[model samples]
Target: MNTDVDQDDCWICYRCHKKLELKQVSVLYLGGRFEVELMQCPQCKMVIINEDLALGKMLEVEKGLEDK
Candidate 1:
């Protein structure tokens, strides 16, 4: 994992307000039509979707919903 802190990419915990580190967290997307990456806060251990991945997943979800 990259240790560099990207202020734009990293998110802080709402409760603790600590910077989320990439190196200390793991992302897992399971049982979805398309694979997705998740960002997790190291301090508070909160999981969030990164912007680009979220958009891609949104597209996939939209397609799935439309097909249904």
Candidate 2:
């Protein structure tokens, strides 16, 4: 996925109030772990899990993994 951040879509870390940068983030679901480029705070390592993702790809992956 092209996680290249668009300035309009930029996110700030809730805890740090810092701009989140694109980095490889570890995601876990159903005992499975994988890395995907995501926006997160460099200082706190906090990741963004937006609504589109929660109801979209992430949900799809979770269901697919659970069916395994």
Candidate 3:
């Protein structure tokens, strides 16, 4: 799977606010629980929260469209 980071969508973590130099995690969200097996951030080594990250990207895209 292609995990290339989209710079515009990727942002510095709120807690650390440092750009995480890592590949995007592919996730499969079920009804009650996530099915992510072993996704991890290369920089901080933390488990990637795929849904929240994707939501953030959507918000960014919406904002960009509104700005136009």
Best candidate (score: TM-score): 2
Give all candidates' CA lDDT scores: 0.55, 0.76, 0.49
The estimated TM-scores of all candidates read: 0.44, 0.73, 0.29
Look at candidate 3 and tell me the lDDT of residue 14. Answer: 53
Off by over 4 Å in 3: 1-5, 8-10, 22-24, 31-68
Tens-digit lDDT string for candidate 3 (1-68) = 33334545655555555565544444444322333333444556565445654576445555766787
Candidate 1 has an lDDT of 0.55
lDDT string for model 2 (1-68, tens) is: 53444546768888998988888788886677867777889899988766676677778888897788
lDDT of 2 at 56: 78
Best by lDDT: 2
Model 2 spans > 4 angstroms off: 2-8
Candidate 3 similarity to native, TM-score:
0.29
